[model samples]
Target: MRKRIGLLLGCLIIISIFTSISVSAMTAEEIIKKRDSNEYIKTAKAESEMTIVSGNRRITKTMVSYIEGDNGLTIFTNPRDRGTKFLKRDDDLWMFFPEAEDLVKISGHMLNQGMMGSDFSYQDMMESDKLTELYKFELIGEEKIEGRNCYVLEGIAIEGKKVSYYRRKSWVDKERFVGLKEELYAQSGRLLKAMKVNKVEEIEGRWYPMESVMEDKLRKGSRTEFVIKSIEFNPKIPAGTFTLENLK
Candidate 1:
């Protein structure tokens, strides 16, 4: 009886050690929070170019954007798309067309439609920083991407939560917390889109993706390359920049 009890105690100790190690490992939720915190700033200004490719055709548009918290305002600068404006306030998104002199509110099924014929949707523009609140995360494993070690994380939308992607898997750089690759899926388990970060640059002591490619799986031979021309973190954005009136 004494020998049996000692064996049981030894097994329990081994289990405890493994359990403690598991608990000490970084969690998926924590990693997501870190990435979000590192990416988002109180206020920022940026200039970017979006190049859309469809089969043999390619089009590029340039735009400038201002962001404050979850609210953002973007205006096209290229001659082809000049004066076009988009505003994202909380959960609402609106667009203004200079030529049509029309202001449109984007919601429901329209949110799923591509933005300016690009792979990005209007809903993708309204993504908030509070990822942990809307999704449950699981740390699947680690992998190497572009010569950098990354943590592989899978996220599922929480019940009753409305999100652009029902499921997502991301490869985030271990040290910089920047996402190197991401796969977005629909609720029915269909792959919708994939995003790859091609380059990263350090700006204002923070790591930011300088260029990224987004591919639409549902559309044959459709892809978009987004490049950040310049960005300023924590810049002082003028008041009313995110308001609907300013969208015009």
Candidate 2:
């Protein structure tokens, strides 16, 4: 009986050591990779609403967006902004004015401006690259956001990469691996924008943010609430949807 008890204790000790090793071996890159796997989609069609809030004033806009690889097209469908479109192909962005019947290319400093008077910039909407491609991430520590445990990570832009925010801090849910909050910063370490997730839903076996808010740090009492009404992942997209010709 004594020998049997000793052998059982030895087995339990070994199991505990192995479990601790596995947990401690998780790297920052692996964490980001898991997050990308859960959030990134090759193609998707989404209907969304954006509400811009400034002080006591609020304006809401409805839009339909198609995303495939690195290209995207968004069209406003609401009565007020009907027919307005934005197209992103490769590194270029173009906007269409339905009333003026004009197509304008967005570049330089204009890319940093708000998208349709919202807190989200044209550059923010155009972000299609994976976090791994644009930044080098380091595991900073762990924190709790909204009562959920999260893995804190800081990402600095990779050299020569053209990214709107030079640095970013993200709080990723430890269980679902979805980002709960993120802070965008300029090269000078000034906070540019902050995003917080209000709701998350399971869609097609993946966790997705259904509602979120983006706040412009430079603007006082201004924020944008973004809600995804519907989304279909890996949806069939018609050809020429991202072309400039389609923008007009």
Candidate 3:
């Protein structure tokens, strides 16, 4: 009987090891795809507030955004930035300033510039979440972030890809597949910025980050916080909303 019990225990141990290996074999690309698919709906609208903190000063701006597939449009509603609009379609990004009555294309070096003096750049705004197409991903390991289990992934931009961050490290929640933290790096392997998700809320059966903070590593004592005031999933958006003519 003792021999039979020992044999059973040995079999259980082997099964456990195989299970562990099977779980670890799941690729980093799968994690990114899961997170991206659940992040944004087919069509959505959001009212958000961006607060920029530099040392002791705080500047806040309110905006509304509409998104469909890879296209997005943002309109500032704050008194200071009222009438300023940003539009992104496919690979092109455009900004319109009512004060100047000019529509400027954001490209090349301008893509790296801060968006509206915030830590997030124009390229960041236009970033595509389809990691498989843009980057080669490697599963680093597992970690715990803010009391939640996470899978750490390192993504390197594929050759000939024009992505903003040449390298990125993301800590994705294991259960929800939400990114809890992320670090962005330049082509020189220099850390450029870091982002942390502070709060999350469920909207229409999907989890969404309600508040997140971004810090520009190049700037001392500077950080930006984005808060989603309200969001609607799969809302009906009028046609031509992403057109330059509609920007006027």
Candidate 4:
């Protein structure tokens, strides 16, 4: 029965297509040039701290996160939890359990659900399925963040069929290639989620985000944060760090 359900979701994925936004027509060469010459590497590390604020109330926790471009996402807790980890590779995501020997892919309608029921959409944590590949680039504008000026970009899905978003906004810092802020929207053009960088620190010689926050505006008073104590980018992480060999 589970296999059948996976097959059905796969079918739905195949059938769902979105309209494409003309990213190629934009300044591809310039974007690549900027990315290549930039200090941001192919991979990066961030220590995250999440705080939940609602109704004059707030809660907080610390976490560690890593991003490997062209590879996928991995999130773990600080001070370590027994076998508690989340890994998402491509379209499939799995959670690891300390006692289990296999990683289990998460499905069901809640696949799009926010992580751990936070305000952030699952898509907010995952790379926009259409970004970098689908959207044309333009150095449309800039903003001041952390006392540094950032490039403001607008992304449109190229051949945007099968997308969860229509148009998106980003504030990318030129020095680090990290987005300081992001906003996502739906096809009907409704605001869906917002991500903000709250703190930054220099680890070793690299400057990286020390704390980050994600809030789901559509859901009242809902949000998540990733707080970090340390981050080592390009560390010798095991190749299997993202596998789902055990899920229990």
Best by TM-score: 3
Ten-residue stretch with the least lDDT total in model 1: 19-28
Off by over 4 Å in 1: 1-24
- Compared with the true structure, what per-residue lDDT tens digits does model 3 show for residues 57-79? 99999999999998999999999
Q: List model 2 lDDT by residue over 124-169, tens digit each.
A: 8778658888999998988999999898999999999887889999
Instruction: Enumerate residue pairs that collide in model 1.
Output: none
lDDT of 1 by residue, 1-248 (tens): 99999999999999999976774477888888788777767888999999999999999999999888878888999999999999888889999999999999999999878999999988787777787888898988889998998989999999999788899999999899988999999999999999999999988888888999999999999999999999998888878788887876
Give candidate 3 misplaced runs (Cα > 4 Å). 1-15
lDDT for 186 in candidate 2 is 92
Q: Name the candidate, 1 or 2, with the larger TM-score value.
A: 2
Which regions in candidate 4 have their CA more than 4 angstroms from the true location?
A: 1-47, 56-82, 97-103, 128-130, 174-177, 202-206, 246-248
Clashing pairs in 3: none
Q: What local distance difference test score does each model get?
A: 0.90, 0.92, 0.91, 0.62
Could you arrange the candidates by TM-score from highest to lowest? Answer: 3, 2, 1, 4
List, residue by residue over 69-149, the lDDT tens digit for candidate 4: 544545445343434567767666666655555555676566678665566555555554335665655567667987987
